[model samples]
Structure formats: C-alpha cells, structure tokens
Target: MRRERVRRPSGAVPPSPFVRRGRPAGAQQDTEADPARAGTMGSKQIAQETFDEAVQENITEFEMEPEEAVREAVLQFESQGVDLSNIVKAVRPPASENGQRQKHQILLTLESLAGAVAERDAARLPQPLAALAAQCREQLALRCLAGRHGAYPAVLSACQLAAGDRQLLLQALAALAALLDGQPDLLDAAGRELLLRSLREQQDAEVTLAGIRCVRHACLKHEHNRQAFVQGGVLPVLTGAIARHGSAAELVRTAASALRVMTFDDDIRVPFGHAHDHAKMIVLENDGLRVLIEAAKAFTDNSAVLSELCATLSRLSVRNEFCQEIVDLGGLNFMVTLLADCMEHPDVVRQVLGAIRAVAGNDDVKDAIVEAGATELIVLAISHHLGQPQICEQGCAALCMLALRKPENCSVIMEGGGALAALQAMRAHPREVAVQKQACMLIRNLVSRSRELCGPILALGAEGLIAEARAAHRDCDDVARAALRDLGCKVELRELWTGQKGGLAQ
Candidate 1:
C-alpha cells in the first residue's frame, strides 16, 4: 500500500467550530464542554445506546470491502439518508486493517462525491458532503502549510489529467480554490511554477480555463498572485485564450478577467490618477488591447466577459499613449455601441463610462468620442443612474474632460445637454465630494478658453452651482474660483455667494 500521507495538525480536519462530525478519525479533536448536561445517568446511557444502535446499523454498508463497494458506498452517501458521522464511525472501527488506506479512501470518496455533486443537482450540497469537503480542504491546507511541494501536483495530476472528467475537474478546481482563497502563501515557488506552467502550456481549453480561474482566484485583490502570474508569463496564455476561444464566452470571460487582475497594481503614483507608463505599455506590446476588443465584440451577449474586457480597456486607457492606441484600434466606437446595446447591467455601464472618462483625457480622443455618439450615450447614462453618485461623478468627469479647450466640442456638449446634466447632478448631490469635484472640474474646463462658452455656462445656472459648491466643499470652492478666474467672473462669483448686489451682469 502507498505510504499514508502525514496527518494534519490536531483539529485541522474539522478546521472550524461549526463542524459536529464528518472529520477523518485521524484528526484528533478536543472534546467540547457541554452547556446543558443533565446529572441523570439514565438519559446519558440511553443516548449512548441509541448511538450504538445507529452505528451498528450503518456498519454493514459502510464496509469498504471490494474497491467497487468503496466507490459505490461514497456515491450512495449523497442519495441515501445515511448519516455521514455514522458512516465514519462504523467503518473506522477496523483501523488496524484499514488505517493505511483511510486517508486515501477518504480522498477517493471526496473525489467521487465532487463528481456526484457536479453531475447531480447543485442547489444545496448535502451535509455529509459539505463536512467531508471541509475536512478534505483543511487537510490539503495543512499540507500546503508544511511546504509540501508535491501537494499541488498531486491535486493537479489526480483531477486535471483525467480527460473528459468534467465533474472530477470541477471538484479539483474547487479544492485548489479553497486552498488558496485567502492563503496566497500556500502557493510556494513550486506550486506557483506548477500553476503558471499549467496556464502557459495547457492545450486543453478546459485545463486552461480552470487554470485561469485559479489564476483569478489567486491574483484577485492579492498582490502576491499578481506578481507571480506576471513573472511566470501568464499573459501570453491569457491573450492566447482570447485569441483561440473567440466563440467560447466563458473562456473569453475567464481570460479577460485574469488579464484585468494582472494589471491591478499599476497605481505607482500616490495622490495622482495616472499609473506607471510601463503598466499599460506591457499590454500594448502583448497585443492585449486588440485581443480584448475582439473578444468583447464577439461575446457581446456575455455580460461578465464584456464587462471585464471594458474594464481592462479602461485600465489600459489611463495613460495618454494607451489612449491614442485605444482610439486607433476603434475602441471608442466599440464602447459606444456596447453601451447603446447593453444598458441593463449597471456594472457594464460603469466600466464603459470609466473607460470613456479615461480616454477623454486625451483632448484628441474627445473628437472620436463625439463622432462615436458618446455625448448622447453619456446623457443617457446620467439619466439612467440619476441618484447614483459615482455614475454622475464619472459622467461629469467625462463631459468636462471632453469639453476642455475644444470650441466645437463645447457646442457638442451644449447640444447634447451634457453640460445641463453635469449642473443638475451638482445641484442634486452637493454632498458627494467626487461629484462636486468633477462638476467643478467640468465647469472649469468649460469656461477656461472660450468667451462664447460663458454665455451657455452662465445660462446653465453654473454661477449658482459654483456658489453652492463654494459653501459645501473647500476643494470644489477652490476649483470654482479657478473656473471664475478662467472665465473672468470670480468677482461675480464672490458677489453672488456673499449675497452682495451689483454682481456683474450675465
């Protein structure tokens, strides 16, 4: 028989306080103090007798006699009303003869249980399976903590290599995900190499998709996984997935999601909006933008994938150089069309708006946005999310970014009612710092260059918006003052807010 795997630390299998049973007998747990124990021996003896009867009854079927019986028994564990604790107690009595294969047998049971769970209905997992899963997960975590390099490959070889084993693969992936949920450290060098290797070299879409899901779980909001993925060259695989799986929405979604995670740590500058130049340049060099845009267009029906793709585009568009590239690749038009088609998903709209906000930073990209019917889209978006502070903030920022220093674009803004929307948002939500700032920024951009823009700016009640902003937010007041100075109307602004008469004529 294969040497028994090392035992987990005491209490490791149960792992949490919620478990009552279903742990491997190998995991020795400390007994808990009873809160309501009666001093009556009669009740205690009767409880013990009932338990004995239950154990004796389950012992017959819990026998792992023929290997096929073992498989059949685990598969039946879910369907029959067999108490999982009973199953363990009945079978564990033969430890001297069975201890060698106890852990292995449990693993097989879990593996089979996972397949059954996936292949069967999944609304609610049975209690036994859940408890057993927790035990297996805790056991694997203990192994990972020991720095056992073989643990990862063991899980991988068992499930990932089983071709056409969808249910087995799903369980294996779930186990890997559970192991690394908040424990990025468990992904040591060898484990990282194995995961990265799988992502890079796997030809099977199922394997690659699972690998990327693991990558998403690992890298999402975790700094360690991001660096490991980047260092291990996971990008080519991500882009390659997008390239090959143009039709498979899930594959595209997973790949795009992974790529989005990889670019998360681009915030190199503090108190500033821009990321490191190299962050977006890497995506540009890797042809990620085109790949993502293509995938997004192809899978327009897949909201999750499309949303991540838009977010990735927005992230990449943070720098001006990438902004130009996004424009060159017709990304602006894609976003406009996407927003027009899919307005029901707020997340999708939010990301698309964020990308537009970033892209509009390039004054040159402003014309493309206009040509792509972006102004109408923003007007609709603001209308869609009227009371939502971030949407209004982002819409105002995009409008102001697009309105700055472009004479015709100012007319476009005015005609599109984009300026009216920003002023209204400012009045509607004066307390939101982001809204006030973006409103002020938009107003500042509007009145900065064109003397003609001032008539429309003043007509939109911007003077009153400025006065209210001055009292509500100091930064907004500062920007409003700058906007007044830019428009040669600070004196009017001061007079209006001070309640003084003889403010300069509009």
Candidate 2:
C-alpha cells in the first residue's frame, strides 16, 4: 500500500493563542500554559477544531507573500485545464486605512495573477493572457488618476512577475505604460525625481530598459511627464542605452521611442527653439544623430525595425534644433544615400522623403540636396505614386519646397523630366481627385513663381490641360471643383492678359 507523509515543519505552530495544535496526536506534554484549562481537556479540543477550519478556508490568502501570490496566479494560468477568463479571486481583510482599499493588497492579488499567467507550463491558460493584461491596464489607469494604493514599484513588480513571457508581458507593460504616460501626476514628486536617477544608477541593462519603457509610455500619455523626462535627463540615458546596449533590441527601441515621444511635444520643442546651434552642439557631443543614423542604416532590410526607426527619425526631424543635429550627423547625406539605394521599399522611401522635406527647408540644405541629386529621386517617387494622392502631394510639397526657394533649380526639375510627369500625373489620374488637385497646385506653384517654368508644362499639350480641368469639373470631388476654378480662369486669364495667343484650346 502507498503511504503519504505529513510535511509539517518541526517548529510550526497552530492558529489560536488559547489552544496550541503544534503537538502531534499524543505529543502534547506542554499543558502548563492552561493552568485553569490544564485539567479541562475538552475546551482545548473544541478551540483547536475551530482554528483548523479557519486555516483550511483561508489557506492561500493569509499565507502567501505578494510576489509569491503573483507567481501562483501565473502558475495557475500555466496549470492544466485552467480557465484564465475566470481567475479565482482571493479574499482579503477589509480596508482599514482611510476608508479605502489598500493598493498593496490589490497589487499582490494582481501580482499573483500575472505570475500565474506568465507561467510557461503547457497547461492551457485559463483565459487569454490578454484578459489579465486588460485588467492590469484598467488598474493602472485607476492608479494613475487618483490611487495612492499602488506605486510604480507595485506595477513594476507585477511586470517582473510576468518575466519570461515577453510577449504577454510586453503588452501588459505597454498598457500600464500607456496609462502612466497619460497621467504623470500619478507619480509622486519622489517617484518623478527618482525616474531618471535610478535608471542612471542601475547597472543592469534590463532594469534600465524597463525604466525607459515606463518613461516612454508616461511621456506618450502626459505632457507634464514629458517635461519631467527631459529635465530628468531621459535623452542622455536613452542615448547611453542605444550606444552601449544596441544589442538589446527592446532597449534600443524603447530608447528610440523615448526620443520619439519627446520630439512630438510642442512644449518640449518650443523651449529649445532657435537654439539650433546649441542643440546641435549638445546633441552632437554624444554622437546622438550618428547613433540614430546608424540604427536607420542597419535596419534597411528590417521592415518593422525600419518603420520604427523611421518614426523616430520623423519625430526628430521636426525640431529645428534636432534637425540641425541630424544634418550635423550626416543624416541629410545618409538619407539621400538611402533614397539612392533603397527606393523599392515604399515605406522607407516615404520616410526618407519626409526627413528630406524637414531639414531641406533651409537654403544651403536645399542647395546641398539638389547638388546631391535628390530632386530626380523625389520627382521619380512622385511619378511612381501618381495614383496615390497623398504620396504625390508629399512629393509635390517637397518639390515645391525644393524649387520655391531656388528658382534657379527650376531647370533641374524640368531637366529631370519632372514637369511632364507632374502635368501628366495631374491629367491622367482624375480618379484620384486629390492627386489631380496636388498636380494642379504644383503647376500653380511653377507658374506663380516663373512664367518660363510653364513652358515644360505647356509642352504637355494644351488640349490635355483643358480636358483634364473639364474632367475634374465633372468629377464628384470638391477638390475637383477647386482644381477647375484655379486652372480655368487662372491660367487662361494669364495667357490672354499676356497676349500670348493661346485661346481656350484648338
């Protein structure tokens, strides 16, 4: 027959102060404490029975540590035949402090829950880890808004309990981060102050990365935290992470995201306005742009990485201060180089175009891009996406930005065969009313600046121009009506007033 051994610790004690159940069935020799009850054996027996019942009912609740609870919850999730949607909730003591439930208790419960979900054993997770993530997200939002119950440590611990299950944990952390991002005031002054300091002090890359992820979400959700981030030296730490720990993709991405978030804030941007020189000097000192440029260059074949890097660059390109830094880091040259090499990836091309438009606003920069042969590429992209109005619009805007300041380069545009393409794009794709609109807008830009610039567009044959406008007028788009209005009287009146002898059309 199989035998089971009871595994009680040698020094373990029973629940009640009135009755001691530690003694084995017959080992109760310490009867001196109950002087009056020493002789009354039935009373101790009755009290011991009640204590055993209470202990059995509340076994898991009063015995487990917060972290351990988190682990158990995750384990339960990983256990066989567990239903995640229906997590077993543990009962705790009623709220005693300030008439409100304590955050630590809630945190412990959640920690246990997250731990159970993160457990890797092939037992079917009771509910999709997504559900737990959702709950944590909701709790995080509550905590951020007005709960003093839990702090970042609690959230951080819960996330840690989810370690090893990167995907689910990432989502959970992201949701929590999003809430914190929305509510920076949720962090106490000490928490706010420690955000960067602790990150700097931590030698572990993972810890630092996690902190950055938190900051990224916080900045994404709150404007005040954004300022706090900048003040707390988030950029410097991010730069450090990128440079020293490039191998940690999450860290790299998180750091990049932090920079991206900072760049999105107008309040953040405005403070460093015309300090382009100073910004350039400070940022360039650490080779910040070089770091970002390297990330962009290395991620050429990685679409996901490319998209993220491009997003980061797009954000960085917005501030003139940062823009100057980009230029100093050879970003203009690097992007122009990428445009030359990777024109096939449309998304990458789109990002390149945006970055170009951002920094090339200056005269010297525009001239440099033209000298470097960017106009042909820009014009080509515009031509290729003639059917995609938005891309064409960006292309045209870029072209206008390029040539508007440098009318001398009008010939470069025309020489590159951009004029005919632009005019044809305007005329051929009436289905994309917006594209047609942009085409006309570009034609207007060309004509408004230089009448000679009209020669190439006019060379597309006047018949097509009038037909295109007429077709636009007949279309359903309001943009079509505006195109007709701009082209009809605007072009013909100029021709007639100039006595150029080009009536409506032959």
* Candidate 2 C-alpha lDDT tens digits along 219-327: 6534566666666666777787787776666677778767776655433323443223323432555556678777666555555455465556655554556666666
Question: How does residue 442 of candidate 2 score in lDDT?
Answer: 56
Q: How accurate is candidate 1 locally (lDDT)?
A: 0.63
Taking all chains together, the TM-score of candidate 1 against the true structure is 0.64
Give each model a TM-score: 0.64, 0.55
lDDT minimum window of 10 residues, candidate 1: 32-41
**lDDT score, candidate 2, position 30:** 22
lDDT of 1 by residue, 360-475 (tens): 88888989898888888897888778788888888888888788778788788777887788888887898898898888888777767666777877877888777788778877
Global lDDT of each candidate: 0.63, 0.55
Instruction: Report the lDDT of model 1 for residue 180.
Output: 57
Highest TM-score, which number? 1
